[model samples]
Target: MVHNYVMRLNNLQRKIREEELDAYLVTAQDSIYYLTGATYDTAERPFFVVIYPDSPPDLVVPELERARMKKAQGIRVVQSYFDYPAAPGGNWYDKINALVGGISKLGVEPSIPAEISSKLWARDIVTYSLVSELRLIKTDDEIESIRQVARYADKGMALLVKNMYNGVSAVELLALSRQLQKEIVKAGDYDPLDNEFITVGRPAPQSAQPCSVPDYGDRLRRGPLSLVCTLRLAGYAAECARTVFLGPPSGSDAELFHHMETAREIAFSMIKPGTPCAEIDQATRDYFESQGLSEYILHRTGHGFGVGSHEAPWLSAGSKDVLEKNMVISIEPALYLRDTGGFRHSDTVLVTEDGYEPLTTYPATLAALTLKDRRPLKSLKGGFVRRAAGA
Candidate 1:
């Protein structure tokens, strides 16, 4: 998808003029990518995009990336330093100070490194998140890119479902994730460097720990299995997660899953333009509280995701951000029980003018997720089972 980098730069420049700043210096990699569509590995070197109120933005990079930056869209000038820790007058900080020397006031992102921000010699330096604010309302190109990413995430989930079997190991699932990633690259015109594809499988007991890395030795047992697919294509990201059962869920497990699904639907029903993010989260919390399972709730109802996996307009009790049209977010309200498994399903949702649209299309129903006829296979040689061999 071709992005309108010129329009994006114009938006940031307009913000710079509105704030009465001579120039706005962007240091965050993701923000730079959003504005310039330049993808590069920002190692220890300082990379920047300085936008002036009336002129085109200037990109600063290490000399190694000078040629690449020259070809990047929406940048009018490319300045480079020889390397990090260079001579007195040839360093990145030196170039930055020289670029803004004529300007009276400068704007910087809030996430700029303290060391870099402190070295700026501008008479007045103000911290702001202008680019991030612009990103809150995605453009047509961005929405399309995110939609494409959602498609890939859904495909990854579908692959997971097809490969899931009783006694499947985390190692095998991870290998499947790699295979799916390769398939996506071959199937689309995506830059391998500009995307990320990961699938995490956590079979129960470990599924209760959402952030814990699954044990390679852990195998799918007769309990809940949580699968998450996080995909990013051409700089936009989407996530899809579902909790399935290895076999028929026990009566208590099925009841808990029902509550989790109901809570997710409640949150989904509240998604629309102008809705308070907190209200959606509050409603989910209220439902869980009424069900006498509030303590099992682990995190917020959802959070916005775009260039970054987690971005603005968070859906939590304390967030003040309200949903706006075109803002993409994840609706993942999860419950974690000790000794039991996690119960959750996540979908990438787009806020429309009237309501919302779900981008990820994986089925979330228990009947659909349950592998009723699959049973644990007998222990194979070396305690390992290849997917094809298992079949």
Candidate 2:
């Protein structure tokens, strides 16, 4: 999709004028990508986009990346420094100072590293999240891009579910994820660097730890297995996750899953324009509390996602953000049992005028997610036919 970077820049410039700032400095990699569509490794070296009130944006990069920065959208002035820790006059700091020497008030993102912000040569270095605030409301192209990525996320989740068996290991899942990444790159004709596909498989007790990474040799067993698929395409991201039973779920497991789904739906029903983010989270929390399962809650209900997997408009109790139309977010209300497993399903949702629309279309019903002890021949044949047909 072709993005109107000129219009985005104009919006930022307009915001800059409103704040009475001469220029705004963007140092975050994702923020820079949101503005200029430039992607690069940001190891140690400082990369910046300087936006003036009247003229076009200026980019500062390492000399090695000069050619690529020159090709970036909405950028006309490309300045480069020799390298990190270069001679007194040939460093990033010097280059930035030269560009903003005449400006009295400079705007910088609040998340900028203190080391860099401290050395900037502005008399008034204001902290502002202009780009982040702008990103909260996505444009038409961005919403379309996110929808496309969500489709791949659903496909990846289905592939993982299809490959599940008695003793599948996380390493095997990783290999499958890489294969899926290749398929998406070929099918969508996207740059390999711009696409990321990751799948995490946690079975039974291990799944209780939401943030722990499964060992390479960890294998799936006969219990609740949490499968997480996160995909990024063309700088947009979507996530799909489900807890499937390797065998027939126990009564307690089914009960927990039902409660989790109920809580998720309650939150979903509350999503709409002008709804306070905290209210949605509180309603979910209230449901879990009523079920006496509040102790199992480990994280917030959800958060917004686009260029960055987790952005603003967070669905947490303390968040002041409000739901708005065109904003894309995830709805994941989970319950983690100590020795059992996690019960959760996450879907990327778009807030609309009336309610919300789920972008990820993977099946989330318990009956659909339950797996047999062995892979069915019919399932294998179906997968083969689908692959043969180039689906």
Candidate 3:
């Protein structure tokens, strides 16, 4: 892990030189962790990593994180403040001034804090630059990390399905998903950086977007429910989404689902080296429109993901990003109908040398999605139980 950090810094240095930048200031949580092995949430607190072409890197963090930052290997100097608002004479500006005191040009990411930027005497070179592009391609070890998390997400989905029933409320379904994720983490002895998202409800009309969290009282019917799970393992991430049906699908629902599947197939088939990213999205949309399901389309095909769930090299119409080997992205083609529900299966895919490979292993077939029980579930309202699944 430490070696990976060193290589990434070296790469960033090269980019700095090419761009004629004197120094690069990084503040994004994911970018900081990607460059150095240090990880911490940036909630309310400011964090930064400064890299210079000629000088060793310096890290400015909260005093609380000072001990943790010590464990990180690539950084040469560690500076900390007791907390936010800064202590007397402990201003980060002074440390930064000392580091790049005489520099004539400085590079910074989009999210760099105003305080730091305002104090810089050098001309600011603002851009994502090497940081964003570096994350687009995953190393062999990074890909393996994502594979493990994808498996965990698959398990979480199975748990949700096993507990699903006709009358199960959206809230209950979400609870089950969380429980399963916790169990998987303990059983596997994995670090707990995993994130799980659950969406359950009847699909809304093409004009109406469904809320990620269902209505408090909305209960599942013998229709479609969308479940999406994203699990992060050691900072590498993968996602799995499936549209499940409570019972055997009706003829109409099956046909709509088939169109959804077709769109997904179109996107998957086009994944290869040098294929323009927008073309994949455009081709999928074209297929859906040709089938006359354009109204039901909600959003773009998918987006790039890694340490951050949504990153660079987005797969969407109007984007010029071209697919490259080791670039990880999600291919999700979905349809929404007022009467039926949402039909989507999002899979994390890797752009390989020859083609693509799906990191998510969950089956997306109709038969595989059919639930066995249509049993009524107990209703719970504001801390009170009003009914049960078997009753």
Task: Report the Cα lDDT for residue 231, model 2.
Answer: 86
Task: Write down the TM-score for model 3.
Answer: 0.88
> How far out, in Å, is residue 37 in model 1?
0.8
Pairs in steric clash, model 3: 203-341, 376-389, 377-389, 378-387, 378-388, 378-389
Summed over model 1, clashes come to 0
Q: Estimate each model's TM-score.
A: 0.94, 0.94, 0.88
lDDT, candidate 2, equals 0.87
1-391 in candidate 2: lDDT tens per residue?
7788788899999999999999999999988988988788888898999999989989999999999777678897899999998999999999999998678999999899998897888888999989989999988899999998898888889888877877766665655677777786677657655668888888788888877788776778777898999988888899999999987899989999899889988998999999999999999999999989999999999999899998988999999999999999999999998888888899999999889999998999899999876556534543553444343
lDDT per residue (tens digit) for residues 315-344 in model 1: 999999999999999999889997998998
Global lDDT of each model?
0.87, 0.87, 0.74
Candidate 3 local accuracy as lDDT?
Answer: 0.74
lDDT, candidate 2, at 88: 96
- Measured over all alpha carbons after superposition, the RMSD of each candidate to the real structure, in angstroms, is 2.7, 4.1, 3.7
Higher lDDT: candidate 2 or 3? 2
lDDT of 3 by residue, 235-317 (tens): 77777888878778889878877888888888999999899988988888898889888888888898887887778788888
Give the range where candidate 3 is weakest over 10 consecutive residues by summed lDDT.
382-391
